[model samples]
Target chain A: MTSDATPALDPAVADRLKRDGNGLVAAIIQQHDTREVLMLGWMDDEALRRTLTEGRVTFWSRSRGEYWRKGDTSGNVQHVKGVALDCDGDALLVQVDQVGAACHTGSRTCFDGRDLPIVTDQSVTTDGDPAALEGDARG
Target chain B: MTSDATPALDPAVADRLKRDGNGLVAAIIQQHDTREVLMLGWMDDEALRRTLTEGRVTFWSRSRGEYWRKGDTSGNVQHVKGVALDCDGDALLVQVDQVGAACHTGSRTCFDGRDLPIVTDQSVTTDGDPAALEGDARG
Candidate 1:
């Protein structure tokens, strides 16, 4: 495993990254075909480099303080389909072709069945006009 | 503008969150209809509560050290369609009906055109069989 002192990623790519104080960026993994968000993980330059070149998703485990390649132990591999960096360069969007469950709980995706109930604004019109609210004071 | 000392989120939902040392979680925003990832933001309990209860998305600006509601200035509102917590509760997936550009750069998405060149493993079969690699030593 490469240390944070030495970045394995291309200098051009590494220079754009805005890592957190811990020298890590959040990686959001999504299913390429279904477009389902599979999971979220942390990655440093090396882990991002490995995922891009090695064709499999790799993440730096914050709790374990080590690097881990997805599906290495569980056989639920995430094959790289595409990778993109967000505008601010603080996050990554990793599109992959998932082989099996993407969650440790055996769910197809990490966000599956984990919805948090929220009050949807009924005032917003179907055309997505918030100003269309009927007599709403919050306007 | 609620302080971190007093959480505004539902107790049940707040209890599940595994926030970072700074008491923040990564929020991944996606377009509801297109399923396109719009952007990524940080949220503390108060921001999460405002996003859930209010019609629009609210995020805590790490740099500005304040709360901001999406579309307040840019008119690129993100009306909440759904919100979910990742399995580990360290991240959030916020589905919304985006009104305009989601990127500060005026792009449709924060990840728009920011693709990284990576070596895709052509050896992996179409059926997603990693073992189907022919004469590949990395198997």
Candidate 2:
């Protein structure tokens, strides 16, 4: 649906995209200065075009099945700082200057305080020593 | 397909996941100290479990239809630093101490030097002034 008949995305840029089965690419938002990941969203060509040229972030809401511009309702604006496509072209990192909360739940970031327990390398000393390797195998 | 008889992921963490149609969640890898995004991968419950307890990053390769552990073949290991789930429980941020290149193309990051042009807020002065707003509308 051509919402406003704005110009399409740059063909050179579009040629690089490797959309998923749903013709969607993952768009990751990060705070420009802090480098903190703010949230993850999906974007199609149209949504990406808007995000790239409108000076704000927009996403194709999978659940809502429609396009939604960030900060339109909640005032949590994401002023675009930069946009980069992954080498595989399946993901985009959109750096922004966030005005307020970046999560739907009003948190500073979607990942804030949501850490999961993970085994770090320091926790397991498998220095290739036969005994340590055997111990790791047993554990 | 339980490859080994290792314990499953923590019940609490497992319950928080919101997998996609492919029974996978997007995992964004970031360099622990630099906070630079390295790459994005997909992980199913099994892959997630392995990553949580294996002290390394693992992903479900959609193209290969199998699980692959990072650095296993490339020798560019991703030593787990931390893992966090988004508020929506549909995405993950995995912080790691990367040993070498994080992309299959042998780049430091999948997104390195792939920036795309984006219009910044400063480019368009929409100060809510009627005249500026009108000008923006025209432009």
- For this target, which candidate reaches the highest lDDT against the unseen true structure? 1
B1-139, model 2: which lDDT tens digit per residue?
A: 6576767777888899998889889999988778898899999998988887777888998889999988889999887766788988889998888998998898899987777765444454222232332222111
> Mind giving the per-residue lDDT tens digits that candidate 2 earns over A101-123?
99888889998777776544445
lDDT string, candidate 1, B19-40, tens digits: 9989999999998777888899
For residue A56, model 2's alpha carbon misses the true position, in angstroms, by 0.3
Error of 1 at A125 (Å): 19
Q: In candidate 2, residue A28 scores what lDDT?
A: 89
Interface RMSD (Å), every candidate: 6.1, 7.4
True contacts kept of each: 0.64, 0.63
Error (Å) of candidate 2 at residue B137 is 17
Per-candidate total of colliding backbone pairs: 0, 0
Q: Which 10 consecutive residues of model 1 chain A have the lowest summed lDDT?
A: A130-139
Cα displacement (angstroms), candidate 2, residue A104, comes to 2.2
iRMSD computed for candidate 2: 7.4
How well does candidate 1 score on lDDT at residue B131? 34
